[model samples]
Target chain A: MSNATQPTAKPDERVKEISAFRNALIRPELGGIVGTVAVFTFFLLFAFDSGMFNSQGIMNWSVVSAQFMIIAVGACLLMIAGEFDLSVGSMIGFAGMMIAIFSVTYGWPVWAAIIVTFVLCTAIGALNGWIVIRTGLPSFIVTLAFLFILRGFTIFLPQVIERKTIIGGILDVAEGDWLAPVFGGTIFKGLFVWLGEAGLIATFERGTKQGQPVVDGIPMLIIWAIALIIFGHVLLTKTKFGNWIFAAGGDAEAARNSGVPVNRVKILMFMFTAFCATVFAVCQVMEFGSAGADRGLLKEFEAIIAVVIGGALLTGGYGSVLGAALGALIFGVVQQGLFFAGVESSLFRVFLGVILLGAVILNTYIRRIITGER
Target chain B: MTGNSKFHHGDPKGAVQPIIEMKNIEKHFGRVIALAGVSFDVKPGECHCLLGDNGAGKSTFIKTMSGVHQPTAGEIFFEGKPMHFDDPRDAISAGIATVHQHLAMIPLMSVSRNFFMGNEPTRKVAGISFFDKKRADEVTMEEMRKMGINLRGPDQAVGTLSGGERQTVAIARAVHFGAKILILDEPTSALGVRQTSNVLATIDRVRKQGIGVVFISHNVRHALAVGDRFTVLNRGQTLGTAARGEISPEELQDLMAGGQELAQLEGSLGGTV
Candidate 1:
């Protein structure tokens, strides 16, 4: 209470020097780092013979982690911006189906279909934002409505067009398309081919496709996930808009009072989330060469679980993309390692629930220590 | 009645026009009238104290001026131009800053982040402008030092600071953002004596910088101690305006506590005590 101006207002010299290591320990990603290491080590112990630690195994997990990371990073950002997009999972399915329908059945070019999908996804995101802001309703409720709406549309659209739940022929469309390589093709295909020829990689035998590596090249999904994480990190920590997200999430009224345009920040966050879902859909549709109404089912919960495990506060205003990236890694290990260890795959969901609850409790406890909040 | 005391009123040197002139400002929340026909103004380099008891429409008046609540009737003239803010953002853009009672600080954010909440310092690096953390910390520390708050570091969380220290940070942030008119609502109501004195001193410092200040308070002593001009509000209406040395603290208190009518009523009903 002694607010009286002191004679000297210099920084306290007797304050203990903050060592580099301690400062690093208090970073928001600490729990995610520990969780990743623990999960990896546990998998290493149980699945060593399964070769989950080998290059091929690592690549497998990386692909799986990449799939989750692409969505989780965006979800993490949205969570930090103080919102939830339950519809993201549904958006992926809807977008994938739309892209396939537009390109293959409707006779549109692959790139044009992608462009149309982008516009449609952006509009959906904007609508979510507008409704949430205009009605002053919680985004959870609003996006849930979108979830059912999009899921129903995804199911009904394919049924009406192709007379089935699945939309195929996208792979055929992708075969001759110029942009296919950018979205779904392997990056080191030529290098892997050379490696296979040099006997550095395992290859198929007694066939026209003999003497080729088991894994041809890095999947674009992995590349996209890494890129998204880096982009999300920079956008969250280094930009003015990043500051706005933290401020808006931390205290919306306070942020608005500071002239942050909280409404616009939130709307943009919703759009970015939808945009991420669309990206995931585009890559996945091309990767699998087919789109189904069931595609990306329960993906919203997985992404959110990944984010929460990454150390984001559910109440909002705090999170890290790196943590989310590591969380996705942990998730990938848990799922793939269980299969490798002969454990039931169904157990992974239960494990996800426990990890989420534990990580959140740990995150909240750590945050309290850092903030010294009672 | 402009009798025996010295009062600084109307105009001060070089303050040709009032920095903010609010006339007949009225705010109605649905059927309930929060503020009715309340007019107040603050001149440049002057500390205008708005005195009112709880439920005296003081909060509503503050909200109206600061753009939390738009006036249903009357007008606000900022820098001699009539202005109606769509919200607080427009009010802030027009160079008016409001520090609410809670101070509107994000507790979990770092001091530097809180200091530069809406408008952070950024510098272009690698074709992208970053938050400029180094500059932010340096400036946050420097601004706080000017306000006589010596912190260990700018990265320290704001919630860990004392109540008074947080108030100083809020004031420093307000000043740093180039606010021409500063409105503080119940700044010292929740503060201790020493904190109150600190805030009063900060107000003195702010006033010396030539920015007009509207300090809302019910405590006559505190208001008279720091205020250059005083406007007392009652029942969503203004009792009157006075100035330093023009009216004693006792007279101002009477006016703020409900003038002669309350005194006469108390006499007729006999003292409850």
Candidate 2:
């Protein structure tokens, strides 16, 4: 692939250059791209007339995918730094519950509740990294322990403070809160209204909301996802710190010898993962106007699955944030496409399993080609 | 050995003050005396080979010199100034670079990435620092070319390169980063004959560039091939230091094998037990 661009008349005879086609096949994003195109094609073929591609339907799946993309970005970075945070789901549930308990039960301002929850969750994330680094334990076991601990606190706290495992009326307290809009609010409302007036999209026909676009505007969740994806991609590919992340994950000892601060990198990645989870939690809380103990269930695994499907090696060091985002997009499309196509929704799990396996196989083959290993 | 005629003992270039000098260096790990009063020095443009049999304190001595281990007692002078290195990074900043047998490089990363791993060149765009990948790639190719390794591309992974090329990458990196004294530990131990020759030639090039080299190996032939001066370590102490032509390969091997110990063992076991 790199040979074609070289203007040098004589190529280095020593380098047994693989063909450009095979070189293209070795990109980490190939699996994710293929999977994404295939999923979109499948949905477009079977669910086309079912309104899956309509404005509202597109918004629905895009929101769902943006959620996965947010967390997958964090998980992908952490994994590439050679760590895992099984507590991501629990962190979400805990963060949401904390916001509800502070704002609703304790009568705190919604903004304060959200900010405090972010700080607290980020601290917990740091603690996770600290323990992993100081004890030399596998991050898998350390984070798995926090998963149950945080989940237990999530359920126990709301019940103790409000006499219920669920908290509601966050929307009422957050009605005029300045910060609430950033997480729960939409953008381009005027544009959507224009879109409706221009007959570019469908509008409500018979309610008090008549003449309004069915999709009010783009959600903040999607905005956050795209921003994070861009941020992560640039950080990984264009910065020296990004190079350090790869080196740290690829070989910690070697990276250390080369003067890369491997420990600090891993710890920051864990904190970033927690920050992402908190972002998801806050968005979900604001959108639903409530918090539940069962919120974000199995989300950690889903995020990992998305990252893996996007072509990240489970062993760490080799991955792409864009690939993970595409994986998240695939997840969202397939999950909703099943509903749109009128298939059994439960089959989504089976599809995830199959796609995950196929991606791993493809990624393994690419790894072998890059490493020249059989 | 073919280049032996090109160097002479006490050559004018070797008469300069040593770039790095260790005096009465000692290291202890609990009760084990890893190094005992070993004095060595390398002048600019000189390849000083440290040869020893296995477990002869060569590894510990080099580790101490490279700042991986602090000497228990010693005086280290760089450019005639006493120095203390808290860690490897400190030594690196002082222009002492060590390329261990296991090169400190990520195998899966591209050549340019691995070449500029820690000390990455960055260009500021709109007040945001981004890796200067064009410069890094160009410099990596140029450096590798200087070492006579024609890379396919800078994007090629380090793992795909032969052992000899990898060594050249490391040496070129150290030299590029302004390493005044280069310490190589067992660079040729695991390489084939052709690869070993390539690395030795690279060492010769680095030496000619006025960088002091401490080449560590037990392979007598390898040391003799590139060494300007030879120091033999035996049982945690230096037997002696000899200029290139002052010592023959057989004599260097005998010293590294611990001549006194070999004779004692021969007396006890009839020489071939």
Candidate 3:
């Protein structure tokens, strides 16, 4: 219509060019980016003198952040596909427990145990998605049901077979195990050793391992977090399947009408979420050399909160994996930053609730902007 | 209207074979019959309007034609060949694309993304095939432009467009994807006067490209504006089909409102008056 009045071709005037500020506000990652900056600024101002920025302190929070990052990446994608997996925490505990049972109680090789655990966990994830699709029930309710079921088994099976809810000795069995190192081992050991030798890093002064860097190497957990984030980000933004994910979450009927395989996208997202949780679990059990029934307690909600904070809509169909990763980073920093700043550790939960509410409000506002609705 | 007039009044109906022909189609849902014995045909470069009121089997007839529902009994000939469509996808592959009232678009998605929702353009680098965003964006803008719509940008959200513009996008998408027969289900039912005009103009542009159009609507004036022939349906039955010059708007409206039933009511009330 705008083309009619002007003899010379001009840009369509109907769509008034939005201000740069407003355009930036429309991005799904805005809230996550802002929150990350604010949280980091606050912690840096308050905890800079407390060794929080030191190599050891950085590693401490990075490890914590990586834990959240792993599961948050999964939750972010699944949420974008318009579903939830409330069973992630339970999945972690259950997967770890299964690995322990398979390796320790059954005396299976550690590699076989880890592989079976991954397969079994992914299968259960697929089952979660299948049940949701077949029954037409809300994914929240379905995954909630699994939360209890998996956690119940996590506690029950160990007690029945080993007479305890906690299993240990995995570190010994995992020694020299091929697959275990992928989840449990560290990388860049030579670099850290070089840094320690060159006096660029803090070295243990008086221990049996004198001159070893306090920050030894980058752990596999952090590596997994980075790898998964990159994978999820690429999968969500750069592929045809990524577009289908957005369409499926935005409107399933519309997507289906357009010939998109909505159900398959949703199911794959669910399985990916479960896979992320298993990675977190395996890394945890390897690092700690034990699996407790409560190993991953409340981790699902934590992952969901991280996703929401990263600016993913709880209602689904709009989000960023990068945003979710940053949200996880915020969680890691603040949780450890509290200790460095001498704040109570329990304040982290309170912070989570507050940040989650703020992020949701921001997301709702962004959604309104995108949809041009109230 | 004047620019598009030459093609609008071309009248290529008789010499051309119908792109789609439905003969004696019947659709029954359990005990109720949604459509019965409805015969219709659309020649290339023709807009055959199916006029009906609510519950006049307009929806049922279109659904049956679009492969949403298998007809209880009927023969559908596409391109002079008898065929059965198992689903909407089958119909789509057969070059019959249906643009439903809601348009089946994600509002928050960019126009380019929505245009290529299911059928995305892609390029491969190092064995990794990714969506070719630049190509998609350019094609979307170019297509919209050809349909007389000047989109702000390819990245502009579909929700930001006017209702008529969205309809144009849907129509353009269907046409771009090799749709030989475009079935528009009430494409302008919820638009303002100007928006409706724009959509009608879009329909005219599409028909001139030699695509058989099945324009389903209850609006008599809309049907009369662009349709080469008008077919009226009532109570799951075809009242009749009339070419453009043979049927007046008043007669078309009366037929759509069930002319015999209206005449019977008038006669019954005459004695009392």
Q: Estimate each model's TM-score.
A: 0.91, 0.94, 0.95
Considering the two chains of model 3, state its CAPRI-style docking category.
acceptable
Of candidate 1 chain B, the 10-residue stretch with the lowest lDDT total is B1-10
Candidate 3 segments whose C-alpha is farther than 4 A from its true place: A1-14, B1-13, B260-273
**Top candidate by DockQ:** 1
lDDT of 1 at B149: 83
Better of 1 and 2 by TM-score: 2
For candidate 3 chain A, which ten residues in a row score worst on lDDT?
A: A1-10
Encode model 1's per-residue lDDT on A1-374: one tens digit a residue: 22355635665465456677876766779889999889878887878999787658878888898999999998999999888999999999999999989998898999889889989997899899889989989999999999999999999988998899988889887777887667788888899888878877666776877777778899888888989999999989887888889888888988877778899998988888898899899999988888999999999999999998888888888889999999988998788889878898899879988998899888888678557676
Per-candidate interface DockQ score: 0.46, 0.42, 0.40
lDDT (Cα, tens digit) per residue for candidate 2, span A26-145: 788898899999999999888999999999999989999999999999999999999999999999999999999999999999999999999999999999999999999999999999
Clashing pairs in 2: none
**DockQ for the candidate 2 complex?**
0.42
| Position B9, candidate 2: lDDT | 29
Query: Candidate 3 residues A1-374, lDDT tens each?
Result: 22222223256656567887898899988988999899999988989999999889889999999999999999999999999999999999999999999999999999999989999999999999999999999999999999999999999999999999999999999988999999999999999999999998889998799989999899999999999999999988889999999999988988999999999999999999999999999999999999999978889899999999998888788899999999999999998999999998899789888998998998998888876666
Q: Candidate 1: where is the Cα deviation over 4 Å? A: A1-4, A10-23, A194-201, B1-17, B23-39, B67-90, B260-273
RMSD value for candidate 1: 3.5
* Candidate 2 CAPRI classification by DockQ: acceptable
